[model samples]
Target: MTKIGKLYGVGVGPGDPELLTMKAMRILREAHRVVAPVSSDSAEGRAESIVRRAIPDVTIERVLISMSPQPVQGRDSAPTGGTSADQGGGTDGYHSKDSGYERAARAITTWLEAGEDVAFVTLGDPHIYSTFTSIAAAVIRMLPVVEIETVEGIMAFQSLAARTSTTVCDAEESLTLVTAIRDTSALERHLTDGTTAIVVYKGGSRLPEIASLLRDTGRSKGAVAGELIGLAGERVTSLDNDEELPSSYLSTVLIPSRSMTKTVEAGEGPA
Candidate 1:
């Protein structure tokens, strides 16, 4: 019997090639062809760079995906005078209506159908807000029996903690991971609700508002504000009171829980 081709979705980690997990690196080097999403300008693929640095010998295939989310019109949707097209087209001014992953799914499935082992490389972990989820969903829907594998890479949160020398959370404390860029109110609630640590994943576009909000909350408790942790370029400042915050895609804000106060006050540091 012929062996069924398998698809491996590998996370390459944030920028650093050495951060790749052993399993991810192994699959990238062993896979028949590696795939990465590219920009409309056809510039070098971001995720591809990380993988190439780790396994430079692997053959790579570029799969272009639109970074924009699809705009859906619901029955109860407010009547905007303009359609999605009026919003200046999709990312890179490409007016193509099809979601990028839809195209990516078909491309991946075609490779699998050809009996080739394909590896889809993603920055950070494949499951953590990566576009691989949609592409994988498409593959499974078309070929239910398609073999799939996922290899975890270092998440931005962990990387941020390492860069800032900050503890994400101890065994005795809880960590709440949130993507609060889209929801300011939710983020405010978490900051004040006494979460052991608040790790915000996507804070690029909403940095200004999030910073201001955090600054106010930290002022009452004399907590530092606007801390952007991760990588050598990390900007870990008190956003609650800082005048400026450095920019980065791998940014994460850590709000340590009150339980850590005793240890901190004792000059004992993180648990």
Candidate 2:
């Protein structure tokens, strides 16, 4: 049997093809197989989107992991449009990432068993709210001999802060990073504890609710919204309360770590 290949989890950054790290680029260039994640909501894969542009000349076998928030409607049938890999065809009754942990693990295992290096591409950094970590854990159990490597990429919060020219922290200031949700209880908790700067990632669709949540806390005026970070059609909207909030899952909200101290420091203001 051929030696098992290594599995690498690479953070491709947030939508910016240029933001892909040198290490990630090198691995993608040299890897024998690559698995790009495609969300259940859309056929388009942001990780694959960046990969296609960044390494136009590279060639490798690739797989698509469709992670759906809910059970996929079609578990037995192949998808209408996409390669076999895109279809995620499996003998087992697994369809979406939610139920396809074993399938994904087996898929990566197949490549590794062939002595092929595999790179699992993810958006932004893998450590912060990424699916790669979860999938990797399952894959490891399936293939105990497989080696796993993790590469860091620029995070959405860091990119958002840079694009808006806002300072995330100023020496000794603590920052809260969490997912944006409709419920304001979490936001209320942070504010109650005197937290100032918060980076809400992956909740672009909840902008209005987020805006309202901030308004309830009287922190709506200084909030900043970043969408599509380094990619085209990027928008950075600054709110001052009472303004309409647009929706985009690619969106990120930046709130000053505190009241009366956080103002726009500088960078590209509003798209």
Candidate 3:
């Protein structure tokens, strides 16, 4: 019997090519085939861009997948329009089958069945709100015995924290991570839930509302927003200045806990 090739889900980190982990680079270079998702045939996905930067001469296979939020009516069918990779940053919401996971899975399966090791490169960590999860699930359903492995990559929030000189959380504190894509209710709740810190993702569209909520909840202090981290047009600024917030889908907002902010202000720094 012919050996079935394994599938590796590789996280390419945020936008910086230098951030790609050594293990992920090795897997991508060694894989029999490398698959990168794209919003359209002409547009290069963020993950693909990072991979190309790190491995200048490497060839990659591009798969078209919708990254836009799916409509309620056609949740199961493929969505029509351009797709975006996870790192491309956009409004966040519940994903649907229309995102084209099944199609991508089928294409990947063909290569695996041919005994070709396949690496699916994604932006950020594969386990964190990544499209890789959907495609991997579909592939598993089709090929039950297929071998799979995941490689961890640095997330945007971590990069944002580093850039802004803010600590995500300290000892005995809780951290809440959410998306501000479709609604701001959850984001509001987390702000007031006694959580030590809150990281809002895909919040570029609702920056104003989020800012208001932060003020109303008295969590506005030390709030920072970052866009296009490690990429062109990158901006990191205080959320206190509404005019400075970049209204791009790739924005990330970090609301540090009041206690931590206070400590930093007093020159005590994070414990």
Candidate 4:
């Protein structure tokens, strides 16, 4: 009965390999096991993608917790094709009624119970809109004895700003990042509120709605689209008009909090 080393939930950042911090790389390369989340049993895993891009040759064991088709299809299965097979080979989809967080906790507890250290990698900073928080919460309640550590990484919003030469905020300003779907109804409130900047975390399908909202509120000039920032397919499209955003999930829109005021103060053209 050996005591297991701690579990490290490492943030791999948006999608760029260079964004990986040295400490995160060091922990990932040395971890005994790595866990990632998957949307479907058939979809590619984001955490694993980060690991492969950072340290392709590491030979640690891999675990995956599928996020959809609730009632977690497989909890005990062997890793196959760089992924895990379901309880019945591949027929049953891997998901859980308890959501991805619970399934991940079960997997991690199994490793911890066996005296094994594990690392769960996530995209972007764990504290910043990452799913690692849900997994962390579950682990704390169910496997209280297991030690947990977190390693932060560059945030997607920061990376996106860097790639586009857009200033997220100055020392005199502040910012708020929210998921697209979660904050739709607050559109009017946020516009009137003094939150320096609003970073719509996922603006794919919401792109049109967002564009419409901005136009209707007369804030279209402050809106811009950033997709796959820091990755190979990165695209930064500025929308001075409301009809040009391409459909994309990795997309985000930035609306300066006092866009009109800023324009007036600087005597600059709108957006």
Per residue, candidate 4 scores C-alpha lDDT tens digits across 114-229 of 87778877777777656677677777788787788999977767776666556556555667666553336655557555446778765565677778777777666556778766
The residue-by-residue lDDT of candidate 3 on 1-271, one tens digit each, is 6799999999988888999999999999999999998878788878998899999988999988766655555344432222366453222333465567778899999999999999999888898878788788899999999999999989888899888788778777889888766668778777766556999986787787888888888787778888888778889888765665677777889999878777766887656
Error of 2 at 143 (Å): 0.7
Q: All candidates' lDDT scores?
A: 0.63, 0.67, 0.80, 0.64
Q: Distance (Å) between predicted and true CA of 84, model 4?
A: 16
Instruction: Estimate the TM-score of every prediction.
Output: 0.80, 0.81, 0.90, 0.78
For model 2, where is the 10-residue window of minimal lDDT? 80-89
lDDT of 3 at 249: 74
Q: Write the per-residue lDDT of candidate 2 for residues 1-271, one digit (tens) a residue.
A: 6888999988889888989989999999888887775544345566777888898776534444553333356543432212122212221222354455566678888888889898988778877666677668778888877789999988877887787666666656678877543344565677644455787765666777777777676776557888777777788888655555656666788887553233432332322
For residues 1-271, could you state the per-residue lDDT of candidate 1 as single tens digits? Answer: 4565799988877666789888887888788878887755365565776777777777788877655433355323322221121111122222234556678788888878888899988777787777676678778987898999999877766766565456656676777777643456666767776646676655555566777776566522222323323233545555545457644444556556665544554677765
Model 2 residue 170 CA deviation (Å) reads 1.2
